[model samples]
Target: MPVRSPLYLLERFDPGVVQLDRELRVIAMNSLARRLLPVEDKQPFEKMVLSFHPERSVAKVKFLLDQAECPVSNPPPMTMIINIPERVLLIKVSKLSDLRGDTTGYTLIFYDITELVSGELPVQPMTPESLSIEKPAPAKRQLHKIPTVSQNRIVLVDVETVTYIRSEGHYTWVSTAQGSSFCNLNISDLAERLDGASFLRIHRSYLANLDFAEQILRDEGRVSLKLRGETTPLPVARTSVSRLLEQLGIGEVDAQRT
Candidate 1:
């Protein structure tokens, strides 16, 4: 059999096909794709797709976007299976580049996997209830203050004063320039409950405030970060290094990477 035209495949292909612009704005979607996904041209893909699922999916797409290469000659595409309410979609995103190997936009192709494997997967709509197994959380929750039980009393602390959070086994300690406070919540609990952009999970056991971050120091096969007005350094993971360095200033440097 002869190979089909790219134009023909795009128009007549069975799988849901979509073309996204550089800004992740939906430019076009084929008939099958439109029927599967509730999307329209010029609509923001992140905002639209995020509506179906946000909490867990945002980080996934972000990783894909970050791993996305510049040109056709670049690295492999980022692909993942996203389970949304009612359907499971295999989303594959890659760089759409010009002839000169310059990235112009992105092409996202989605395949509905639900039909392939019936009742085994959760087909229920990814509702706020279903999404929040721990607690009934919406797709997005705006957080202004952290509520914690202290001295047998509920204490509401402003979000800005928080410098970092340290988890000691079951308990999570929220630190500030003023001092540290004990919260019944765990570090992972705080990671999900609070504003994610404001707090960076520098390591498994620690979350650092971007506002309070002063510098990242690497020494003797170990990596640590410093916050404003703080003496001791916090642990930094290898995977978290690039993002931290890209965002915050680098202070002291030693020999090796952790």
Candidate 2:
């Protein structure tokens, strides 16, 4: 929710990159995106969709393309699975903001989750007792949880695979290595549902999984935490930096939030 550095964000979305105008014309594309383009239709993105499995998905794809032309009413990150020639790509669509902080277009970051679908890497379920945080004495009221991420459907998610939970206006987005989904609960409500040892709230808008905490980055006076499966760094609060580092088993060396 703070001013995020665009430079790092660009780095986060490495490999798959495609820039489009409001009308959905391909303005610029990286080498990876270029490679995926069909030989005959190198002109514009809207006219040329590479390949799709179910025919109905084509219409859904177009709706998302149109959603990116301007600022989105609810930006919780939309994800769709599309099949291209020989590969299955997981496209994560995020809103791209302009100088005035208005939504300009959308950015599509592609990830190949074919192997995962093929049963190579499986989604592990996380239990509250399996985490490694200090336990407080049992409370009078029993705290029950499903440890599941739900949008339209519900799937039990392991705490280890959870990357982060972010607040987007009234909704909280829960993202795992498997995928991301919108939760009906607010950030505070979602945080209480997660295991304390593994999940920590770094910012008022961000709760992170320590298991995925890869590195802590301090760039241009802003401190952020880089998770394993994500390209973007989740912003950390200046006041909670020390405590977060301790929870993640990271040493201190001038970590501050912008």
> Which candidate wins on TM-score?
1
lDDT of 2 by residue, 1-258 (tens): 554332333234335667665555566776666554532444655644424224534554675566445344555665554443333445656677767777676666665433333332332222234221345533221112223334422333444566898887645677877778665345765566457888899999999988788878887767898999899998988888888978866567534331
Clashing pairs in 1: 85-126
The local distance difference test score of model 1 is: 0.61
Candidate 2: which stretches are off by over 4 Å? 1-151, 254-258
Count clashing residue pairs per candidate: 1, 3
The TM-score, computed over Cα atoms with residue i paired to residue i, of candidate 2 is 0.41
Candidate 2 global CA lDDT score: 0.58
Cα distance off (Å), candidate 2, residue 249: 2.7
**1-258, model 1: which lDDT tens digit per residue?**
665532333344356666766666666777665555544432445444334334545655655565676333665666655444444455667788778777777777766533232322222222334333365433423335554445433354667888998987655777888788765445765676567667888899999888887766667767888899899999999888876766554423422232
